[model samples]
Target: MVMGFREFCDYEWFSFTMENYVVHILFSKSEPGPLLEGKSKYVELGGVYSAQLHQAHTSVGQTHIHVYARNNQLFAMNHDGSAHDRSHGSQIPNKVAQAITQKFPNFTLPKDNYIESAPSGIVNAFGHQLLLG
Candidate 1:
């Protein structure tokens, strides 16, 4: 997909970057419903997405979306806490990563740790525990 150059983050202004390719952008409950329902090609246009990326839902959950791109790398955005909290030990993350690696062996992770926004009711991501903010 072709994307126009724009200012991203604080100091990164990029027109096009091969190194900045996104494998996926996972979403939670608050995502636009049509995109999750496959009514639109927005999610699939530039990357792959899964509405059922996770098998379980948290107490305060909404729909979860996963965006997968050309590489094994993936990211989570717009996800709520309860949904992510419930899916913690479901082998989803590792499984997803494995699948991506199987297909894109050359894909590299941009960071040693994955970054996800705090959920609506969470302030931190703990081991199988998301503390409410």
Candidate 2:
């Protein structure tokens, strides 16, 4: 079922923040209906393992529309930076921290050179970096 922008945001906010789920937002500058060829596109993409369809909306006075999907894969990456072949060692790197903050304005990393220490198996998901210690 398709949902509106407000509903989508509400669901996303609740799921990501309150429920600790990952949400992937796909935005389009055009109507998503035609582009998606109706709901069947979801199945064609990757079945249930793929990102779940959340909503598609066009701006009130504009032609742009956006599609939102959710999944948990974003946090599945190994925190050792092994996925990228670089060991961050206890603290998040300055450059990496900066990029995270830039992508998510609401997020703030410690101003100090490094964070105290993160817990094991921390993952960066849903545009938010999870530093569990």
Candidate 3:
């Protein structure tokens, strides 16, 4: 199955390819989507484990996407190693928080999680469903 997002939607979307293309979409519940226009970037989100992700999150201005699980809940957050890491919903807009929080099972801030940032700005985040300790 495939999904889509709006071009101007507040939520960010990402794509990765293996046998088929899968898009990681961040969305809100209030806004219905026919489909979201996702990113054309190549990323390798691990399926085996989540511990492999760790990065330099010290600079807020530095662009990066972080994905991790805590209390059995999946989360994706932007920028890291900054003072703002503690404040949930500090950076995200009201509409964005509501959309993603309701749309996806993943939500909340992350730290020292699997981080990714290509040549382009890092926005959307992906996490492996199976947790491995």
Best-fitting candidate, scored by lDDT: 1
RMSD of 3: 17.6
Which model is ahead, 2 or 3, in terms of TM-score? 2
Clashes of each: 8, 1, 12
Better TM-score candidate (1, 2): 1
Models 1 onward score TM values of: 0.24, 0.21, 0.20
Q: Candidate 2's residue-wise lDDT over 1-133, tens digit each?
A: 2232433432321123225545444445344323452452321122222212223233432111111123322211122222211223335435544544444344334335243233223333321454332
Error of 2 at 4 (Å): 41
Model 1: CA > 4 A from native: 1-42, 47-60, 71-73, 81-114, 124-133
Ten-residue region with minimum lDDT total, candidate 3 = 113-122
Candidate 2 off by > 4 Å:
1-89, 117-133
| Tens digits of lDDT, candidate 3, 31-117 | 455342233232223332121122323222333333323222133353342222333323433443344345333333333322222
